[model samples]
Target: MSHVTDVPAASPEIARDHFLRRLSVETDCSDVAASLRGGEPDFVLLHVVGSPQAYERRHVPGARHLPHRDISAERMGEWPAGTLFVVYCAGPHCNGADRAAFKLAGLGLPVKIMIGGITGWQDEDLPFASGKEPGVLRP
Candidate 1:
């Protein structure tokens, strides 16, 4: 009998976790702003489920929209290959951001979830587009 060494591939969950930990190109709103001011951000903004309404009302000016549910190879063509992308949901309690990150990483794209989502951005007192609220942006 011959013995063969076998190693399992990393699961999606593990892959997502690993990617998040190793991310050095990620940015929150403040970082995003700095990058934008410096010319362009290092990453692209991705909106999770139900975030469209909020996004359309106001986003980071130049941010492009990539809805979570519509994520796929076909839809991904709109974005550059291996672009440093950041996914964001409504808030910390939401898992949409993480889910989006997982999907993006699975496609071999360098990605990360903006830890606090839009809520955190507001907390930073950063500039954002407005819609329903005086200083809030929503689609």
Candidate 2:
């Protein structure tokens, strides 16, 4: 058999479960951008990497500057217990998003990773917000 078919695909039930599970914990740049444009999003978007200066240089429109290292129970207390956090880092090569997601999950909070991160966002030719604080894109 060809290398492409060396192994059969998972059963439909298995594939369904896998895709559903991934959707639950992950989102892509396009989906996020669309959400941001659709009015107030239900999730809290966070730029989970870089310093304040780096974040100020460029970041997702509504993303807050919250480094993964700063993620903690006390800091997260500002949000409701059921708040859903969407995190992203430099790109797929960076683990800041994963680190933030892990910390959020450990804190018993809901979280999802924005899969393409900044790189992916740029790949889609989307505009970024620049400023010293969060939600700089807001009117």
Candidate 3:
């Protein structure tokens, strides 16, 4: 495992080192979508809805709901065995995703946090579903 040093230095080595470290265990929203399309993922996608009403309005496709306040041992099994997990919340500045990521990682599961969260996904022009996700590619 590469060491992740949270330094502010702008040296080329530092930036390269950071990128290499992140490459070992880092993924983003686009990766998740591509995996879903290819049907070859080893992980499940989870979206922690900060607000029930917002969740009802729209969310990522195929996301399983695990409210922030409701994540616990009892619900940890909601995820699949040996599956990597990706967690996202309302958006940036939202602790829901961070908390969920920490909790899943603590449970000894490989997990990735969508740093920008759902808001960032939307900002990037990604598709979302309201009501039912249909579990299919959206136009």
Candidate 4:
């Protein structure tokens, strides 16, 4: 038998459990939107990267701008303990979100990746704000 066949396939139950675990750890655009609408206080949305021009073009309504390179525990000190930070980048094509998430998690902050990033948000026809004004993006 080929070397690949030597490994046993995961049982259906095991696969299902793995999938559920992964799903539980990741947040989707719709969930983020709902949380924003409900004014959920347990989590914060973070925009991982995007230039000023990019931000002006479009961005998640309430996402805070913090480049991945600048992410640090000190910079995020204002947040309370156990805050679930939902981080996103430009899109699947961009890995900034992954980098930011890794950094934040390493810093002992609770973090989850916003699957699909801003592209996914826009794909869902979610509202986005333009310009440099903070908290100006409205649905």
Question: What is every candidate's alpha-carbon RMSD to the true fold?
Answer: 9.7, 1.5, 5.7, 3.5
Best by TM-score: 2
lDDT of 3 at 43: 70
- Misplaced by over 4 Å in model 1 are 1-26, 130-139
Model 2 misplacement above 4 A: 136-139
Give lDDT per model, in order: 0.69, 0.93, 0.72, 0.83
Q: List, residue by residue over 17-105, the lDDT tens digit for candidate 1.
A: 98776665355766665666666466676666575576668655555566777789788878677787777777788888778888887
For model 4, how does the per-residue alpha-carbon lDDT over 1-139 read when each residue is reduced to its tens digit? 7788899879999999998887766889998887777764468888889787787777887888888899877888888888888899989999999999899989988888999998899899888877775453333
Q: Give the better candidate number (3 or 4) by lDDT.
A: 4
CA lDDT for candidate 1: 0.69
Residue-by-residue lDDT tens digits, candidate 3, 1-139:
3355564557998889999877545567777677767765567777786565666578787777777678776787765677777888888778887788788778787777766778777776788876644254343
Query: Native-vs-model 2 lDDT?
Result: 0.93
Q: What local lDDT does model 3 show for residue 30?
A: 78
Residue 71 deviation, candidate 2, in Å?
0.3
Which one wins by TM-score: 2 or 3? 2
- List where candidate 3 sits over 4 angstroms from the true fold: 1-14, 23-25, 132-134
**Clashing residue pairs found in predicted model 3:** none
In model 3, how large is the Cα lDDT of residue 34?
A: 76
Model 2, 43-83: lDDT tens per residue? Answer: 99999999999999999999999999999999999998899
Structural RMSD, model 4: 3.5
